[model samples]
Target: MDADAAPRRVRADAERSTARILEAAEAVLAEDPTAPLERIADAAGLARATVHRRFSSRAALLDALAAQLAQRYVQGLAEARVDTAPPVDAMLRMTETAFALKLAHRFAVQLTASMTPEVQGGLDRLFARLREAGAITAPDPTWGRRVYLALLHEVNDLPADSPMLDGDDLAARAGLLVGTVLRALGGVWPPAR
Candidate 1:
């Protein structure tokens, strides 16, 4: 074997283990915010000592989860093409992306309670674009962003099997959310504002 192969394999193993722990933590914490680290370990199928070795404390693990959530949000926004898409189209895309991320990371969404600076900056730019395009007519456009985020939170709290969140229902949900936000911001309903 190459001299570097052993270390590379070990690093890959560590990364996988850490990812498993974070996924398990999100699931366990979403079900019960006060679940213990041992419970998280059980969910991850990892030994308590392994979890402890990976994250020195619960706070550290939570911090890692929050970081992962922020990274995913950034990536989702990019994939949604928020910067280049038409304002209204971008809003719909962003809503769909946020909805999925919020559902996947319920505990992190609740824990953060606010957008990370990067996410906030991206949304602020998008809202500005919306206003420039007349898709938002609110004199104070900040309310638009707030309302958009509030709608995502509401949707995120829905039961996993809700009809609104069924596999093919995502587009309809996104359209409803974007349309409501536009109207709430004084834009016309049929997206012609």
Candidate 2:
């Protein structure tokens, strides 16, 4: 049992390090896209060698960042429960959740502007449902998606350390973005605040 436990512990440690590296990469790269491996290692509180061992090169690190962003985007959508709620309610919730996520992962999303087909398909399905329910009248899912992303991305550019970034202010920002995008998408006027 001890022998089996040794390998499990090693695996757990590796996973933890990998997660740390990915997170550190996101923060560092967001600030300096050309930041060196040493910066990321310092941020992760690990040696540069450890990061090299986990990720062979800068490209590899960026690749991992893209994958993480894709996963996080899907998870954010799922957590918003857009499919289960009314169109306006779901849109607001999803907008708020997505804004929060994008704000947190600014660099990751920038690196992965075009998501995998699987992620895009999921978004398509959600928008289709909204259209069928008459919540939105956008003729093209891609257009609606582009408009929504543009709005969300702009919100992420807001001053991070601003005192106005409290819950109410964030919610208001999300509401504003949602209202603007929905209107642009031919969605009904006056989304629930």
TM-score to native of every candidate shown: 0.89, 0.86
Q: Report clash pairs, candidate 1.
A: none
lDDT of 1 at 157: 62
lDDT of 1: 0.82
Per-model C-alpha lDDT, please? 0.82, 0.77
Model 1: residues >4 Å from true position, as ranges? 139-141, 158-168
TM-score of 1: 0.89
TM-score of 2: 0.86
What are the clash counts of all predictions, listed in order? 0, 0
Over 1-193, each residue of candidate 2 has an lDDT whose tens digit, in order, gives 7779999999999999999999999899889989999999999999999999999999988888888778877776677666776766667777777767667877887775437776676566677777777768987777777777777777666675554354445587777777777777777557444
